[model samples]
Target: MVPTTITLHNTGNPLSPAANERGWLTNPANPRQASFHIVVDEREAIECIPLSENAWHAGDGSGSKSGNRTSIGVEICESGNYAKTLDNAVKLVAGMLKDRGWGVDRLRRHWDWSKKICPRLMYDDGKWTGWIDFKNRVNAELKGADNVKLDSEKVNVIVNGKKIKDGKLENGVTYVPLRAVGDALGATIGFDNKTKTATLDMKV
Candidate 1:
């Protein structure tokens, strides 16, 4: 299932390095039943699991409609620099929102899914206001971004003086559907599963 929401988490162990956290989650012998999609630190972000599959990060138990089944989990490391860690998290989350075609409204705290106070720094001492601040930052990152824009304005496509299809404008760029382009050009498009390459045969 395509992830519809993003869940934030904190490593909880303030001393555990980001590499060690990644190792623990990925180690075959550790046998810890917990996992997350990505772990972010002040230095870099590490992906432990594929976004296409659900991770056991959310406190929500096994269920059909649980956050674990539908949302992507991101754990922010609390090691080294606190401010840098938050900066990295904000960048990572903004990129995810851009890639997934989601807005800041889709962002959720771990507490929103369960009773856990994960991402402790953002929720501690009744500081839920921090979440709102984070969302605002994400929204700022999204403006004029490279992601697709969901707009109602239709862009008409013309080929050889004939209107073929309609496209959409994203960040001032007009993007036409690939299939539409192929059809307009009178080319046969084929995909190779093994090589994952798209082939256009103009002779056909």
Candidate 2:
């Protein structure tokens, strides 16, 4: 799918984190059909589906010109740390736009697709002020990418009361090993030889 725009959304549920949203998307027993390419939270961005695939996130019905078909879906988790989550989302989304040679004009809110007031948190008293602020942040991020230098430090990655592996801290974000994460959760890991994609599935 050739994405013309990056569609942004809010998970709506204020308590669910990025990992939980990813897990819900990957779980087979989930009856709801909603899906997204990525989920961003305070800590990191978790990919639920490949970017090349179309996610049924935009409320618009499936069609050639529909947002679900023309845009890549990104849901920002609205948990406790909204400020941090927005920062992480800014990095992730700005990086995506930069990598694709796109500008802030390519960013679209879920409301742009359908009438649903998704990303409701961003609506400032029924005004687009919050959306404008978010876009401004993304624009600043895009401009600052070239001038910023990232520093790294080693840190402990603790999962379920166990230190699985030493992780790295960069730009105020911590990076952990995916294998260790899967192992800690007792998830079955598989690698697709053709696509070179590593998948972690739970034993159900």
Candidate 3:
């Protein structure tokens, strides 16, 4: 799976970071057949499963065809300082979104996929607003829209060993049309005006 969405989860166990890491590594197929892409704590974010493969984390069931197969699952550890743990999760999620060119709208709570109240800290304490706030923070970290300026400057763009002249720099950030970049890189690019979204198709 290319991970079109990000799913948030909670470990629900008050285990040390190392203990949580060990659990995932040692039990690849637990009773629930549960697994996740990454486990995050106040100190670090540990990747247990490969992002290229889907993990059975969404709890939507084998035949449901849900987030377990389509989204990247990140379990936040609740055994430490909750604030620090959440900050780590935010950074990890922001990095994932930046790498994939995805927007905050792609974020999904585990609850969104299934009936499970996951990332429990954000759901149980009347703190659902925290999830929204997290998305907003991730969007701001992307720096694509909120940090750009109207003024344009000339910038050289090279794609597939060829120079492209349409690139521009605004507020010290380089900008290029998705279609132009995709074409130069031999990929199909599409835009959805209604959603203001760009889709890129690359041959793997």
lDDT of candidates 1 onward, in order: 0.77, 0.83, 0.75
Q: Which lDDT tens digits does candidate 3 get at residues 46-83?
A: 88889988888888865535898788988888887776
What order do candidates take by TM-score, descending?
2, 1, 3
When summed lDDT is taken over every stretch of 10 residues in candidate 3, the lowest stretch is 124-133
Clash totals, every prediction: 0, 0, 0
Where does candidate 2 have its weakest 10-residue lDDT segment?
Answer: 188-197
- Return the top candidate by TM-score: 2
Name the regions of candidate 3 deviating beyond 4 angstroms. 28-30, 63-65, 124-127, 144-204
In model 1, which residue pairs have backbone atoms overlapping below 3 Å? Answer: none
lDDT at 82, model 1: 70
Candidate 2 lDDT, 64-129, residue by residue in tens: 999999999999999977877987898899999999999999999999999788778777456554
What is the per-residue lDDT of model 1 for residues 1-204, given as tens digits with 9 covering 90 to 100? 568899998899888767889899757788779889998888989888899998988878878788999889999888898767876788889989998788988998899999688778766355454565566657767885334355635789997676765777766788764545666787655544346555556753
TM-score head-to-head 1 vs 3, winner: 1
Residue 49 alpha-carbon offset, candidate 2, angstroms: 0.6
| lDDT of model 2 at position 155 | 86
Give the TM-score comparing model 3 with the true structure, all chains together.
0.64
Best by lDDT: 2
